[model samples]
Target: MGLLSQVLLLPFAPVRGSAWVIRQVMREAERIYYDPATIRAELASLEEQLESGEISEEEFDRREDELLERLEAAAGVQQGGGGFG
Candidate 1:
């Protein structure tokens, strides 16, 4: 079973408001809150800006890597066991 499925099977796992419970459980996944769409858009804009000489290539690459790292960190935080709370 998947991790989520296993978690749901726990004896005290709340079911009635399970969505809220899960959201609360994952809330500290990260402080950065850019949605996937927004992140993609921002990355595209950064790329275009760099190509157009509006921003330095170094700046573009740095910010892009930082955003990607944030995304990875958030994913890790979410996948982590109920250890954040």
Candidate 2:
């Protein structure tokens, strides 16, 4: 590319930089969200809530299922090297 092209595109540099930062943030968020340790911590917390009656059995079961699915997916990713949903 010529210097003229770089000069012309300089106006959009901030926009492009912002977009890249957003993508990186999203990827990191996804990584943490699907992390096995994070999911296990949540499961433990959910159990604690149930024990303390902070959540009902029905609610615990519902949320437990959701968390278990996330764990299964994370395990699959670890084993088969897949991407997060």
Model 1 lDDT tens row, 1-85:
7999878787555664687777775764523353445567778898899989999978998999987876666567657733334
Error of 2 at 31 (Å): 0.6
Q: Write the per-residue lDDT of candidate 2 for residues 1-85, one digit (tens) a residue.
A: 7999999999999999999999888888989988999999999999999999999999999999999999888888889877653
Candidate 1 total steric clashes: 0
Candidate-wise lDDT, in order: 0.70, 0.92
User: TM-score of the candidate numbered 1?
Assistant: 0.48
TM-score leader: 2
**Each candidate's TM vs. the true structure?**
0.48, 0.90
Residue 64 shift from truth in candidate 2, angstroms: 0.6
